[model samples]
Target chain A: GAGVSQSPSNKVTEKGKDVELRCDPISGHTALYWYRQRLGQGLEFLIYFQGNSAPDKSGLPSDRFSAERTGESVSTLTIQRTQQEDSAVYLCASSLVFGPPRETQYFGPGTRLLVL
Target chain B: AQSVAQPEDQVNVAEGNPLTVKCTYSVSGNPYLFWYVQYPNRGLQFLLKYITGDNLVKGSYGFEAEFNKSQTSFHLKKPSALVSDSALYFCAVRGFTDKLIFGTGTRLQVFP
Candidate 1:
């Protein structure tokens, strides 16, 4: 079976510029999530999208960080006016469904963003 | 808030030797525990998870973890180590929220 995939394996952008990272979840997955992994740190939850429901944006560090998933397929995480601190690996994951007994999340290779 | 802690920043073990990576969690109600491994320059790979039922949960690549309810811990363990098993391991917990809270991570180095 095909696993999750992400585009732009690496991205380098100016500090003030905006960058968009894309994620393609596995087929038939109904839930998708985005997270940020900084150097020497743990993964920070960014956002979550379930089929037809309002995305959970509680983990977004600032208003500049936003994400959107169309239906139950691809998703895009956009960082507006990127900052040096925004440099990190953006990872995406998806599962069959979200639950009390949550399903395992399959991850993508991730997009490494470097804000210079 | 829900959180996880990996006490050791790094663990070194010789190949064919047993290895253990510690993880403790704090969360309200019953916790959903997970283990993930990351190779350098790559994304995370799910190892295993402890949702309920058994105390010991087996996962991919001959790895397993024990979920201790009273101790609030879910420590990853392997009976024998392999050099190829070296990587960054993370313990995560999902509480009442939809998001998963991850620990700082533990680097495992298996030397031949």
Candidate 2:
């Protein structure tokens, strides 16, 4: 089966610019999530989207980070005024559903963002 | 807050030898534990998870983990190591929230 997919395998942008990373979840998946993985660090939760529900933006580090998912398919994570600290791998994952005894999350290759 | 901890930054083991990577978690209620691996320059790959039922959960690529409720641990283990298994392993835990809290990660290096 097709897995989650992300675009722009690698991105290089100047500081103060805005960058958008895209994610396409697996077919039939009803939940999507975005996370940030800094070099040699753990993954930091960014946002989550469930079918027709308000996205969870609790993990966004600041107002600069935001994400949106249309229906239950694709999601885009936008970072405004990118900073050096924003340089990291942006990963997307999706599952069949979100609930108790949560389903396994299938991940995408990720978009490596570099801010210069 | 829910959190996970991988005590070792790195673990080295010879091929054909058993290997273990430690993980401990802290959460408010019953925890949903997970294991994921990342190859160099690749995204995370789900290995296995411990939601309930059996204490020992088997996962992809001949890997398994033991969920110890009393200890609040879910350590990944493999009977024999393969060089191909070398990668960054992450332990994660989810409580009542929709997000998973991940550990710092453990790098596994298997020598031949």
Candidate 3:
């Protein structure tokens, strides 16, 4: 892929319902990241995956928010029992590599999730 | 913990005028600073970053940012503003991990 791509540009779910957001990183990029942005706010780090290493979940808002990445390929962010506060744009980004200081992160168009 | 601060909630500039967006950061060790731009209904786009070397870093859209270590600031600057440059700008600082602490976004409104 030329750039990071996310599926279902917009999602609407009822309160307490679950929703799944998908991300396909750029080809061969080993680093993937997820972020949440409220209406007009800055990004909030959700989670990140780097190669085969254990994901750094420190930023996940809560246990309800979990994500998985398969061998540096596609990744999915699942929100269990979604709340109204979960309504925000879910963004995905990928970098060619990590550990070289600030690796430029290419972002996806983002999936707008709205919990009604 | 690493954190970033964008003092201005909004910056208004006229076309053809130089524009500036202020940013400051706090971190334990060396900080990796970055600026990202977001257009209407779009995800953030990386504008530039400050890692090492020169204090000035140039990025896309003919914009550049100066890293002032003494001030712990990395302010975005453009000599000439364009109407198309109106957007939301964010300053972020990378921690020891991949986590990037972001500041409240600053909206840039360039008037033609």
Candidate 4:
């Protein structure tokens, strides 16, 4: 794809339900990131993946939030037992690579999740 | 830890006037700065970035930013504002951890 792509642009789920969001990064990108944006809030880092190394999950808010990436391609973010506070826009971004000075990151449209 | 701060929640400027959006950052090592723009219901779009070299970095859409190492600031600037420039702007910093930390963002309203 020309840019990062996310699926299910909009989602509404019950408070106790689980939701999975998918992301497809640009071809050849070796770095992927996931972030969440609450209403009127800045983007919050969630997880990061670089190659086959263990993902940087330091930013994951809680055990309920988990993400995985296969190789350097598609990634998935799963939020279990969603809470009302979990309602937010989930964004995905991919960069060419990661190093001391990272390259530009291309973002996806994001998935708006509403936990009712 | 790395962090970014955008003090102003919103800025209003008239068309053809100079515009500025303030940003400050804290990091352990040399800071790599970036500016991104967001329209309503849309993902962020990269504007410019400052890595190494000149303090003044020019980017897409006639936007530029100046990096001040001493002040720990990277402020976005446009000599002549346009109403079409009205949107949300964010400042980010890449720290020693190799992760980008974004600021709260500032909404720029360029009125005609």
CA lDDT of every candidate: 0.94, 0.95, 0.92, 0.93
Model 2: per-residue Cα lDDT over A4-102, one tens digit each: 999999999999999999999999999999999999999999999999989999989999988989898889999999999999999999999788659
lDDT of 2 at B51: 88
Candidate topping DockQ: 2
What is the per-residue lDDT of model 1 for residues A3-116, given as tens digits with 9 covering 90 to 100? 999999999999999999999999999999999999999999999998998999988999999898989999999999999999999999999977766888889999999999
Candidate 1: list runs displaced more than 4 Å: none
lDDT of 3 by residue, B1-112 (tens): 6889999999999999999999999998888899999998888899999888999999999999999989999999999999999999999998687767889999999999
Model 4 interface CAPRI class: medium
- On the 0 to 100 scale, the lDDT of residue A73 in model 3 is 95
Sort by DockQ, best first: what order?
2, 1, 3, 4
DockQ of each: 0.86, 0.89, 0.77, 0.74
lDDT for each residue of candidate 3 in A1-116, tens digit (9 for 90 to 100): 38899988999999999999999999998899999999868889999999999998988998999999999899999999999999999999999869975587889999999999
- RMSD after CA superposition, every candidate: 0.8, 0.7, 1.0, 0.9
Instruction: Give me the displacement of residue B73 in model 4, in angstroms.
Output: 0.8
